[model samples]
Target: MYIPDIYKNENQEEIQNFIHENSFAILVNQTDGKLWATHIPLILDKNEAGKDILVGHVSKENPQAGSFSENAEVLAIFSGPHTYVSSSWYDHENVPTWNYLAAHIYGKVKVLNHDEAVGSLKKLVDKYEKKSKTPLRVEDLSKKTMMQACGIIAFEIEITSVEAVKKLSQNRDKKNYDNIISELENIGDLNSKQMADEMRKNK
Candidate 1:
């Protein structure tokens, strides 16, 4: 991801928070000279020592999972709320831009074995089930069944590097930023208004 110096987010805590809040991410990998992508929810794990890792799995039939070997550079993009910013809202003549928050993480991935894959499944289950009224539960799949139904790929990214961007109107004057906020707030769509609210948070 191309991030300008002004828009760069170097705060590790903030970046991790963004990833947690927007766990659904686009997983990108290089295949046979082509880029392959898949959208999936990922869990961020942090140890007591503050070391961080990422965990996720794709469907068994999804070809993207097979592209990564024991050590492959992979990127996962987690996007937060964003909206279009019209140039008309700026104080001076400026190009139209987008306001948003995102994090891109690059790391090496290793395919997990069957036993390790089972733990990954449980983590996914716990995440989705935590909010259910009945708390739907999944019993561990048999080794044979898990090996069959699950493409059963689990990989951990050591987070070799991360880049985050927060493209709000930080470069603009207060008046122009306020005007943009008011305009966004007046938008009828809920998401637009939500984006506006988010923008206002940093002001």
Candidate 2:
């Protein structure tokens, strides 16, 4: 994550909130001299010591899961809305650029035991199922369905570093920034609209 000083975001609360909202992240690791990445939902949590951590699991079938061990370093990338910022949006001459928000979390992995793994799975299910018309609980699953849990490897990532980046055209002058937001909203796509909103908040 090579971030310029102007784009670097040091606000801890904002960074954590962004991570939670974009919980589905790319988990990156290396094994056998090969790099691997897995996309999964990682829940934000706190360990017994009250330090922030991430709880998640990967399918045992995923080759990336083969490298999990105590203190293995991993990187989780959480991405948010982004859109192309055409140079035309600027008041003066400038090159086109992309505006987006993202967070990179570097941490050490801690594999969970069987019981702890299942508990984490249960919590994961409960959180996503909460808004369902007929919410389902992990306990509601039959023994055969529950057997699927055995096929996953749960782990916790003790957060060691967080690099938060929000390149929302903060360097632009008021007129250019306002024009960019207006153009983004006029584009009418979900991502562009979201980026416009983010720019407004940042403004």
Candidate 3:
């Protein structure tokens, strides 16, 4: 999360959109003086007072599930596509580098009650299942199934700070940047294509 001034992106709307697009996040916290991490999908939400919140759940059996206490500090990382940029792609001599996008969110964690957990599950299902041919709705689950699902520990993080970076070769000259984009697009891989798209957007 060490973002240079040139690479830092502080646009609130853009940051929020990026989080929504890349909802899967790495949640990190410290427990018993040791670091712990979990990879999970989280939903970005807003409170009645318009404060940003992150919602997610962990299995009750997960040790991390017990780490949440009021105002516990945690970090959530939303990583986007990245690819290696060869120096050969540049018009002039240069070293190879990486082009990527990522956001780091620091927040205070809060555990949710049973009712809130149920609502969080419903929202998560709706968000991900929207594009499915036969979309699954949380309401369609049997009472027992729903109860079991809600058995997981739901939590919310109130965002305290955001640090985002878009390292899309902004330091390169226009010609070299264009070349990188062109080469990446022609690579025809998911990560390369995504890097190309991000470069184009920033360009």
- Best model per lDDT: 2
State the lDDT of candidate 3 residue by residue for 156-178, as single tens digits: 99999999999999998898889
What TM-score does candidate 1 reach? 0.88
Q: What is the RMSD, in Å, between candidate 3 and the native fold over all Cα?
A: 1.2
- Candidate 2: the clashing residue pairs are none
Which is better, 1 or 3, measured by TM-score?
A: 3
Model 1 Cα lDDT, one tens digit per residue, 1-203: 89889889998888888888899999898877788898988899853467788888877677777678722889999998889889998768989988888999998786777677767777877887888887644464455655553555777777888999988888888899899899988885765787788778878
Worst 10-residue lDDT window for candidate 1 reads 136-145
Per-model TM against the reference: 0.88, 0.97, 0.96
Q: Judged by lDDT against the true structure, how good is candidate 3?
A: 0.91
Name the runs in model 3 displaced over 4 angstroms.
Answer: none
Question: Model 2, stretches more than 4 Å misplaced?
Answer: none
Clashes of each: 1, 0, 0
Which candidate would rank higher by lDDT, 2 or 3? Answer: 2
Error of 1 at 55 (Å): 0.4
